[model samples]
Target: MNITIKGKVPPKAIIGVVILVIALALFLLKEPEKDDLIEISESDSIIDEKLEEGDLETTPVIQETIVVELAGEVNNPSVYILTKGSRVYEAIELAGGLTEEADTRNTNLAAILQDEMKIYIPSKEEVKAMEEQSGTKAGSDYIGGNTTANSSNQNKNSKVNLNTANSIQLQQLRGVGPSTAEKIIEYRNKHGRFNKIEDIMNVSGIGEKTFENLKNFITVE
Candidate 1:
């Protein structure tokens, strides 16, 4: 159909059509960029959450502890806080170790310490005098050592000599039992002799309470 409807097209209608086409093109181009921005935001959020979780996992935990009271012959004798399973040697180190007059012969440095336990270190001269009074030869009757002895003779006063007392004589103390008596003798034999009645508490199992029960019946002489 060759219909010649000449004249010019409407300028307003052409301008409107062109504007609609440009707007459609802009929307199409911006859609992918909007989606990309959303994806980047989601990824950052995920990374932040993971970092927070990692921080929680890497936190440190504190260890359990025990309190022990140290006294006698140490440089600084006071109550000390120690980690559980700490040894007697460690406790001594915390208390500034043994002083010049400290006699550590009866101290079980390797023994694992208990909470509220007290340690007493005797003097060297005190131990020497006790050994002399007991007339105990240096190398005789060593517990778990080479020499052996006959049954110990009790003193006239009925006090057990911490230096020369055998297991049987040690058992005569008020609170001393078969095991504790053996421990006393072993301590005496291994470390020379008890310097004073208080030094008996330096043994592994003996504490302040045990010392109280046997103190009156025991003597270093």
Candidate 2:
């Protein structure tokens, strides 16, 4: 349908109308983009949090150290710091190595070090004195008391009298500590004097292995 108008529109009014249309279009397009950006930001934040949690789980923990006293014939005898699983030799080394007179033959250098343990290193002269008193040679199978005999008579007189020996005497045998020595005395007291050396095995904690180590050194007669 054709219609006739007799008025002219102002240039400023037309320009304002055009500007309003452009602004409305821009707002509609930007709204969806803003919503998309917000969603992406939230997802990135979640991923970053998950990564941080993973890093924490994979982090390594450090082990704690132990303190021990290293004494005896070492050059420097004092309390030293060490890690777990350290051996006696390491402790000795930390103490500035052994002295010239230190006798290492009796020391178990390969033994594991314990906290507050005292590693006493005896002198060579002291070991010799002990050997002379024990009657058997130093570092021999015989443990505890003094013995004196020639090589031909060594084994004959070196045996410990199990029936008559007290707890202190019993502790002189290799592998016989205070607890094991006490057990032996207790067993002997309860069951009467051991009739045979094998009867020592009847004591609690004195197993076959202990008996094996002690058989040569002990006697009932």
Candidate 3:
């Protein structure tokens, strides 16, 4: 008997269509989920923000102003520029350390420094005299008997005027200390105006040597 042809497709074509459907189903299932992808991106964004904040905190900051001075027996005594909070040691190091002759024993390397302070390194004679004074050693002229010599020197120079002297004017003279300064003021109160610089000879304790020292450092006019 002859078989009638049916409307169904061929076996090879059916197989091909089935295979295509399976491939499409797999593609749809394997595609990334939008919510999952969004969650991952959100986690990455959080990490980025945290890292940014951390980086900001770790950044170094610089200070605007810093100044320091080194003086006294240093190879080169000078003021130096520094970053804020830099220590005295740093400045000393910059100046090439202390000279071989510098007396470092009395110096405090760790001392915090200020601007424009005079750091004096005393000479050997000066140091010895200071020590003698402190110990009150016999035969040491720690009381400064040199005042007599100073008096004699002052007498040789032009005289000073006590009554008319302004502090500015008075300080210009050598051998004038606070005590002498006060004396001049007192003399001014007792006496009227000074007739001339020569009138200073009348003041007690002033002499020729002191006047000579004052010559360069003072002015009569």
Candidate 4:
């Protein structure tokens, strides 16, 4: 003999199965990735901050030009706004005037000016032509350029007393020679300090014209 059995689910079991199916479907259709949501939130916050601020303060950039003051031995010493290629002489012109003792003869007045160059004035004796004339006229057989020979010879003949000369002391003066420079030194040693510049004339070969020329560049003190 054979026996058969039939089974039917309860109403609660069917309801629970339906609820689980709904939950699984919701999870499968979820919104977006967590990283994407976080990125969207940060972007929205940044945009909100920008919109909240009405205006932003911006710093201004300024370009500046420099000006310098020049005085001392110059025709017109004063404050000058120099361009890129100004020279020493140009600055000197800004100042009122140069002292009579200013030694400009050695200066390359035509030379370009640096950032802070001091253009000094020259004295009468520092660039005297007499020494040049004496050297040229003393001997006409000189083969060098007529004008150049005279100046060259004069420069060669002129000697400086290193021990006693000032800034202008090394300049060429009339009748100055190696012997004269030595004599000037000897005098300074024997007689002590020179109270006056005129004492240079006391040395042999330093005539009145030489002394006059030297007066501009020389100082005893």
**Top-TM-score structure, candidate number:** 1
Cα error, candidate 3, residue 133 (Å): 5.2
Clashing pairs in 2: 133-146, 134-146, 134-147, 135-147, 135-148, 144-172
TM-score of 2: 0.42
Superior candidate under TM-score, 1 versus 2: 1
Q: Per-residue alpha-carbon lDDT of model 2 for 1-221, expressed as tens digits?
A: 98988799899999999999999999987776778889999999999998978755555788767676655567997888888767778988999999999877755577565554455666676566655555342232111122222252345346767654534446668888778866775565345557888888899998888889999899887
Residues 153-178, candidate 1, lDDT per residue (tens digit)? 42435666677554444655667777
Give the whole-model CA lDDT for all candidates, comma-separated. Answer: 0.66, 0.66, 0.50, 0.51
State the TM-score for model 1. 0.44
Ranked by TM-score, the better of candidates 3 and 4 is 3
lDDT of 3 by residue, 1-221 (tens): 99998898789999999999999999999999999999999999999998978755555686665555555555777767766555456677876676665544433455444443233332344334333432121111111011111121233344333433433235435677656765554454345344656556567777777656654544334
Sort by TM-score, best first: what order? 1, 2, 3, 4
The true-structure Cα RMSD of candidate 2 reads: 12.5
- What's the CA error at residue 180 for candidate 3, in Å? 27
Q: Write candidate 4's Cα lDDT for 96-195 as tens digits.
A: 5566756554444454543433333434443454334432322110100111112334444444333334222333345455566546644543444566
Question: In candidate 4, how many Å is residue 180 off?
Answer: 23
In model 4, where is the ten-residue run with the lowest total lDDT? 140-149
